[model samples]
Target: MNITKNTTGIESVILTSPDPQAAAAFNEAAFGLGARLQVRAGDAPTSGFRGFTLSLVVPGPSTVDSFFESALAAGATTVKPAKKSFWGYGGVLQAPDGTLWKIATSSKKDSGAATRTVDDFVVLLGVEDVKATKQFYIERGLTVAKSFGSKYVEFAAPAESVKLALYGRRAAAKDAGVAPEGTGSHRVVFGGGLGTFTDPDGFEWETLA
Candidate 1:
């Protein structure tokens, strides 16, 4: 397969949920984003975190608070309440279908800063072998921004594109304060310029033709 460098990162993600419509609606409202592709897996058992969490980075505390509140109103359960941290304000939310989300802002309020879209969006995938998966993407032309031994890794994608991260499966679940539930259909469809492929962890990535 010819893996072109995907400058757009992830254009969309197809999630498998017992209630596909509810999952779609929750995501659209919570992320202020939309998916380009949709697929349904009839009545599959949803499990914890599913080895990934979608991240949204905004500008300041207000945006974090607002987005967090909006997520709750949209039927997402609060995994972590928004709080101020050294990095900025952040929080976590779990959609009805067991998809975890982390919303954060690393920048302080700057009155002179022009309003823009969310600062960054990322798809954090948990894998059993970070080194191998990291190498897989590296061979496919993904630049690495930061890496820590074999435990964690981050890829360098465009600012406007969805970034990718890798973490140990158990560690990722712990980070989300959930138990590691091993092996099930993650039901994720990736949309961009890349082709369809399944990672070592059974997470699926599909692309736009």
Candidate 2:
């Protein structure tokens, strides 16, 4: 799979699947994100969301409502309906491949103004030890954006690139209201320019060509 981020920091991940064209169309229509899919030369495993989720942060309550409705119209299953939260307005959905997605808006204003597009995109992973995972990414050349002891950590991605974060596994599961049962192949493929490496939590990441 190939993942690219737009100048707006919105990422479009192109992947090889049983039917690339259809897959791409589905993703684009479903999430309003770019995707390029192709039939694979080898067997493809089923996809699932076990240890991680893709987060899309928008500007306001209306945007979240619109996006959530759009996703549902495009065949996404609702994991949670959008609602007010201590953090902000947000909801969850499950793609056809079982990838979990969270759409949210922060309560805090951006630069004292609201953002109209995706404010940030991140691959949030649940880890056994947030502090150790933060250290691991730090040692691998990733800069830190913020960290709260071992409870959570966010990494600085290249401008307009998809960001990464780590959180306590149990906490993450609790936040998602799901049981933490990640195992086997993660189904989702990650490719950027960071080279191929598996995090301590067994989440695989690959560098872009």
Candidate 3:
């Protein structure tokens, strides 16, 4: 076995947009994602929910609002406004590049002040068969950190990189405040530390350089 080969978690994420430069600028302005998140130009036919979401889990409600507002100022359309929920506080938006994003926190109150930092950067893949896809990742050397039957699965990742999760496709769309129907290329890719292969849901993973 090639033990040196990584086949577990994501190292980075790339979004394909019609205007790569504008997309990269939006990311820097809204999230300050730096190099971990990237963009390239590719305008393949895609509409509605693209079967995934990028979420920024922040520290507090204040931080959530900060990111949410920044996204709006960067020309993102609001899918949901920043508001308090039973789980905490958060909001959803679609970037000009056509990527859905959620900025959120578990703290209802302010801890200190808002920052452009993230407590957790999550890539949630909306798959048709969560249980089967979860099993596929397991066989590919991904260790499950959390599992919820056929509904959801989360994989462990290095602390400095992004986290990975799986969710039901339709349910993911509902959470994103969009209709649950889309076709054509997902227009996104993952720089997984793992070697390259496409998942059951058609999400692509590339070997991290």
Candidate 4:
């Protein structure tokens, strides 16, 4: 899965779970996502479903409705109703790729946010031609932030940001600044006021604020 973000921050994650509804319920009860969007994923050999979407509780009411409408017009569905409740506004949507999503609103403002909430991160794969990758993101409506040589690049996405790093099987192994005894996929995690994780391929991701 390639997660790309630019400024907005990652509102949610869409994955293939054995039980989408149950997974949504578990997440909602655990993290307070208010609702779930329904998208059917074939068990197997069913040629797979068309698309998928999963929503996460966000901080405001801003353009959520409009966002949903646009998403829907671009091929989305309302598997569940959106309503106001103790949590906030809750809704569910089906993404164009048969992904299920649950979206909710949070009213509490962070007392310490000098800017916005310093939370969440998305990991994106990078190509050896990082300049081209960065340009690609810019053309795709994402904001390019940092490019660290042909070895890595980073982009900003709505609600979340993305980190892209070039991974040449042999070159990266040598660039690790370590003895290349054993290597496959590696993981790096950073935690503090914000938390982040790097995939085996050196892409960094975080969930915070």
Candidate 5:
């Protein structure tokens, strides 16, 4: 049986943070993303959800500068002064909601990745109810896998060549060497339409087709 699943290409990563501005700033400098937009409550162009907003992208420095300038005018605050970092290019800004944002160009180490080619990335979701989670994926026409006595399940979509694994929140926390705060503490990679999922404990697996 075809066990591997796939999903539509992930366009970007949405990070949930208490201080999105700081998080965004750190990400830009550390990961090399340019600001895309900074939406705020009431004046926000989207529905639901409130608070500060910021986005980063991977592009040329010039483009990022112009984009960030507009974001600052819209509502974002300047965190660290935007300037060249020791690691090539980097800058920091704050979202109107008090989230910190950072942007920068990819350093050689960041861009010099040696990852294998793949069709798409996968998500490892932490769930309180494993059975219900499995059923949810099943109803969605996804494939599932399990090990004897293992409180974990794997779901894959063949069409998108993407996979999602659900595990007991506690078990996942143990595996990730984290406290399992019931929130996302692991890393979900999204780039080049291919990446892997890394748990808090640093477990990694390729999600390639």
Candidate 6:
């Protein structure tokens, strides 16, 4: 049997925050992510860049603006303001709890009325070596959907599951407009069918069952 046949890329993501209640409230108010995003009480000491950023891919520039504006209104500080680029429109923001969020879209203009709807949620983990981490996830049954040499890798995930990707630490931080230096816990964990195996960068994962 092909052991990788039954692999589920990423079933769930749990954020370990120092203030669970506040984190929960802020997330709900900001994005209404529902059960798609999870949070729990954690005091694991961490500082500076947490080595990851969550991305929200929306329908158009309008939708991107909707999320970007709301996140700012809900206590998120601007890392990069929403703006149109050659690829599309997007921006980065840091939540009150220090989570970096990237809201973006590939369309330069709105096709319809603007609404706060999200098209995709991506978890971008920053590692020291993209090639090594990509190989590691591949060995753990994650099928690579898109790859850009050693600079980045995007994994295929089940529908409704959060998408996973890997990027270099400095590049990921630069994309989020932050310093690359960091230490201590990543303060996050993933639950999936791949079982419990921490990535090379020290991000933890637990068995879904």
How many backbone clashes does every candidate have? Answer: 0, 6, 1, 33, 24, 0
CA RMSD per model (angstroms): 4.1, 5.8, 3.9, 15.9, 12.6, 3.1
- Tens-place lDDT digits, model 6, residues 1-209: 11123236667778889899988888888887787788999999999999999998989888888887778888999999899898899899999989999999999988998887888889999899999998898888888788889988888777778889899999999999999999998888988788887888999989876
Task: Compute the lDDT for candidate 2.
Answer: 0.67
**Which model is ahead, 3 or 5, in terms of TM-score?**
3
TM-scores for every predicted model? 0.84, 0.80, 0.94, 0.32, 0.38, 0.94
The total number of steric clashes, by the backbone 3 Å criterion, in model 4 comes to 33
Candidate 2: tens digits of C-alpha lDDT, residues 7-93: 221133334455555555656676655331212222346433377777888888777777777778777888888888889888888
> How many clashes show up in model 5?
24
Between prediction 2 and prediction 6, which has the larger lDDT? 6
TM-score of 5: 0.38
lDDT per residue as tens, model 4, 8-120: 43333333344556544544333332311121232432222221122344455433454455446555667666666576665666544344445556543333322222132
lDDT of 6 at 82: 91
Which model is ahead, 2 or 3, in terms of lDDT?
Answer: 3
Clashing residue pairs for model 6: none
lDDT of 1 by residue, 1-209 (tens): 12233354666666776777777777777666644335456565545557888888888777777788778899889888878777777888887777788888886564444333577778888898999998987766676777888998887776456788899988888767678885556757666655677777877777676
lDDT of 3: 0.87
Candidate 3, which segments miss by more than 4 Å at Cα?
1-7
C-alpha local distance difference test of each model = 0.73, 0.67, 0.87, 0.40, 0.43, 0.87
- How well is each residue in 72-137 modelled by candidate 3, as lDDT tens digits? 998999998889999899989999888999888988899798877798999999999998998888
| True lDDT of residue 112, candidate 4 | 35
